[model samples]
Target: SAVISQKPSRDICQRGTSLTIQCQVDSQVTMMFWYRQQPGQSLTLIATANQGSEATYESGFVIDKFPISRPNLTFSTLTVSNMSPEDSSIYLCSVEIGLHYGYTFGSGTRLTVV
Candidate 1:
């Protein structure tokens, strides 16, 4: 099983400012997934970060707005740029922890844009 450590559990930022949240997994995961959960909506896959390739983002997300980095197998980072009130959401990282079990998520990073 992999344990994930995510930082900046919550933040309140100015409208134009940006926030970078980091996720560190205990073990190497072939792929790490980033998701956004809005106030009243379901989780949307933001991107998938792999060790040696560019991240693949979802339909509505672009690299310019939601850049992701996976320097290695166990670490990754996601930055929300030019944030606005509408961007407020819970950002989480997930990876399959075991064969029998499913994905396990880190403590989400909750952002509030003002």
Candidate 2:
């Protein structure tokens, strides 16, 4: 299993402002994903981070709104740009350990937009 350290456990920002959340994995991983959980809602897949290449975003999510950077095998960053009140949610990063071990998630960054 890998340990994920996500920074800024929580934060409050004004509307239209941007916030960048970082995720650091203890071990190298091949599959890393970013997800968003809105209040009282299920987790929605945001994008897949590929090392040495651009991230692959899911439907309804564009790279302009949520830019992901995967600089290496163990680290990545997701930025919520021009946020609004509707964007307030818990952002989490996950890594798949394997078929048997399953996936591991970060503590999550709780963002509140005013």
Candidate 3:
């Protein structure tokens, strides 16, 4: 029911820097989620961007480190603040419509902090 478009497909930044990755959906969605994936590893859910409420972060992930905003139904943004080498990973945006429609994701933001 939706397609996602993410900005800054990849980036390399210095330590202590910050990056904001955006996700745009083709259709209205009730939910949006941010995820991170390391090389050769599975995706890790970062947080859920609520329509009218603060994002719910997963364990070991906090809002201060990865802040998210969902101002409307078809858009959301995730900011990775204070980058570090250990923060290098692929950040993704996902949206699920229904059981039949399944989930769709953006191309992803590959970030590397030196």
Candidate 4:
């Protein structure tokens, strides 16, 4: 099991501003993923962070917008660049221990853009 922590539990930003959220894990995980949950919507996978390599982003996400950094095995960060009100959502960092263990999610960083 891994315990994940995220910073800035909630934030309100003006349009065109950006925020960077930090994710820390207690133990090294094989797969670290980032997700976004819009209001009343399901969680959408943003990217998968692989150690010693560039992050693999899912569809509808680009590196220029949501840049991810995995400096080491147990730490990662996501920067939401060029923010817009449409981008407001709960961004969560998650990790899967195994197929049976399912995924564990961070409390999430609730971002609101005005």
For TM-score, the strongest prediction is 2
Flag regions of model 1 displaced more than 4 Å.
none
For candidate 1, give the lDDT: 0.94
Q: Which is the leading candidate under lDDT?
A: 2
- Stretches of model 3 off by over 4 angstroms after superposition: none
C-alpha lDDT (0 to 100) for residue 20 of candidate 4: 96
Q: What is candidate 3's lDDT per residue for 1-114, written digit by digit as tens? A: 677889999999999999999999998888898999999899999999989999999999999999898999999999999999999999999999888987899999999999
Q: What does the lDDT read for residue 16 in candidate 3?
A: 97
After superposition of all CA atoms, the RMSD between model 1 and the true structure is 0.9
Q: Write the per-residue lDDT of candidate 4 for residues 1-114, one digit (tens) a residue.
A: 679998879999988878999989999886799999999999999999988899999999999999999989898999999899999999999998867978999999999999
lDDT of 1 by residue, 1-114 (tens): 679999989999999898999999999899999999998889999999999999998999999999999999999999999999999999999998668879999999999999
Question: lDDT for model 2, on a 0 to 1 scale?
Answer: 0.95
Error of 1 at 20 (Å): 0.5
Q: Who is ahead in TM-score, 3 or 4?
A: 3
The regions of model 4 sitting more than 4 angstroms off are: none
Which digits, one per residue and each the tens of the lDDT, describe model 2 over residues 45-110? 999999988899999999999999998899999999999999999999999987898889999999
Instruction: Supply candidate 1's per-residue lDDT for 40.
Output: 82
Go through the candidates in order and give each one's C-alpha lDDT. Answer: 0.94, 0.95, 0.94, 0.92
